[model samples]
Target: MSGTISRRSLSSPLSALALLALAAGAVTACTGPQAASEPEASRSASPETGQPVGATRHMIDNGGHDLAFYVTQGTGPTNVLDSGGGEDSSYWKDLVPELHEATGATVITYDRAGLGQSDAVPGPWQVESAVSDLESGLEQLGVTDDVTLVFHSQAGQIATCLAQENPALLSGAVLVDANLPPFFTDERIERLVAFSQPQLDAAKEDPDDPQNRQLLSTAESFVATSTAFHRATWPDTVPATVIVSEKTPFDGSPEDVQRWKGAAESFVQAGPHRTLIAADDSSHDVAKDRPDLVLEETENMVAAQR
Candidate 1:
């Protein structure tokens, strides 16, 4: 459940059985070297992993509501990260500071309202509300300089929507195992949701929990916004790179896997600036499974800023 963003599928494009298998396999399948990049061995990388050495926490007031965010100050561009559905800043625990160490850029991570250390907000879970929380947080943090966005899982919707609404604020983007909004069809999602009904019911019973709130919000509102986003013309001005898992996290049939890759390829064509890279032998929780690739793709985005 972490994308440096959560492992939550905004809507799985595959069958429920496959996704269940994918989740079960994701835990044990990635046994290799996903333990952050080697650059993290630097003195600045901090041994604690999640808590960076010099990072400090701050609260941004969104009309009396506070959004919790962290800052690891660096010298170059600002790298702002948005975690996937049901996750908060902690999702990026290991990668956040390591990223700053690698790039010498200001690295920021935040808990979307109702998750992590942030306060809760009422919601049908509208993407607009999530985007607003981020905007206020960034503005309050004085992010007026260059910016690169690293969005994971459900946060992909937020990143794309933000780019559409506030492209001027961004220089480049890295979509890590992000939601391919254009590829989700209603028939597929309806089936996936119906299959996930049991989990949804459990969360519905405890709706106040952060993950639950995020899950409910995603179920209620995220897809429509994502669909609408795909309907609009993609923003071609900003460069974006998509990092996908080499192995399907939600285990699908061979045909399912091929279709998923096909969709990823199509998504890469959204703009001339878009590129798609498949991480080696990873699952849906790709950031955790292959932190090295996440670091590399993010660095690629930072370099692509124009």
Candidate 2:
């Protein structure tokens, strides 16, 4: 925990242990924060509907800071695509139009605080803040009900909190290779924090780096946040579809892999409308590896809602 973190602890330019920190609902910097002073506005008139296929970007004021949102025009049952740790709204760029075209549902994607075009707030990452951003952003967008939330990885924590706090706002959800409360057991959280410590320490070297800043933010509140998350539960009334990748985020460790998949299984089993689908030939990033599967499941969920 005091030295260089092993690659097996996580991966990539963010840090060797970013995934571990990410699963713990900490260290959200995958590609770090980029300077996005203004939201880019782009649109192309669609041939079929004459509506804009490209996203109409908006910089919504959430408290004092701005959270960037890309909204595609369509009908009701708004589909919101939220990215994982270290990612921004652009992560869903490829899937937005496809979803909108298929379901004729208003598609939305946004950058979390500290990522993409959004303004970053100082201090530790708070799930409550994340939930507030979504709630307020939707309210400002005039999105009231029948919302389908599709989220991945670290965004799962936000989804969990949202379901508990604002279950009335959502019609359904699609969780793609997301971290679950069952996976954040006490022993698992201890190991995750331990694995993430070295990376957290390394973050201090380049304190100004946005990625490091995010990693550092976790140092103060990761354990507390993750501990609280472990005891949190998704409402049984909210129907959910869980897509679990074959090679989980912890594919490097067989023990963790089983636990990860087990969590998804347990989650689905605990509820009435919950379903689990296996992404047979994918890794932790199932959306990228098997978007067809993700799309299929999401479309099914949306159809069920209608």
Candidate 3:
């Protein structure tokens, strides 16, 4: 399942984000492609409990990004968990092992550039750079195939781009309270751009300030432009599942929530190979607020694939 992507096909950050929001909801219209048959029940691991209990953690240099990752190998599909904004690889600490135990797959979790122990890049974080880093990391780890990408928040854009451009490298994708398409309007885009200037200026003033630097790094990483919004559409080949958050508000308004729902619904309607699950008690941090629900949905999705 080797996949290739042309540099020319990559979408701008705003475009990617828009397409992601659209693709994220379009899942309901898409059908799951026939996958290879799984082993008998006796051989399959329980999704509720996860895999045997050991994990190996390491740091790898993907280009210049110092990516810290943890691996738990299983007999099923490989799982790559992408952390949310300002979060590190440890974001999945409690949930990853549980997922591994239940599904019996090779599970991997990593810190994005500038977050956790990984060093941040010098400029604003560009979507292309993040994708490149992820691809490089996968190549370095040698788990290019048999991989299922689980993304949270803004990572949805990255995961969407990877699936669209390099579908062969992925088995499937799971999005947790992710930011998607249609969520970006001209006004929203302007707001995002406007919101980032202060942080950017702050970073410019004191590049060494950890808090200011982190703020600038995160803003630059995704919201610096509209490329992410435009590239959010799926290619109709990849399978996806979106776990929607019922409690958190991206913009803290009903109108904003409706926009988010519209974007999510767009993704579901665009593709047949998708599922939408709602988490009522949790906010954006689905993993932290309700690990049990996240684990359950993850199990269901994986089992369905198996």
State which candidate has the highest TM-score.
2
Minimum summed lDDT over a 10-residue window in model 3 is located at 27-36
Candidate 1, 1-306: lDDT as tens digits: 111111253233221311210000001111121112123333242444355566677767776677677788888699998776666677788898679888989998888878776898876666666777777777767775478989876777677667777777888888887766555555445545655666678778988776766666666653465456445444787788888877554444444455556767888886688998988778777888999998998887887663
TM-score of each candidate structure, all chains considered together: 0.80, 0.86, 0.76
List lDDT for all candidates, in order: 0.66, 0.75, 0.62
- Using lDDT as the measure, the top candidate is 2
For candidate 3, the TM-score is: 0.76
Q: Candidate 2 residues 14-96, lDDT tens each?
A: 32233322222332211213323233434443342232356776667777788877788798689999877777776677788
Question: What local lDDT does model 3 show for residue 275?
Answer: 76
Q: How many residue pairs clash in each candidate?
A: 4, 1, 58
Order candidates by TM-score, high to low.
2, 1, 3
How well does candidate 3 score on lDDT at residue 63?
53
Candidate 1: segments with Cα more than 4 A from true spot: 1-50, 253-256
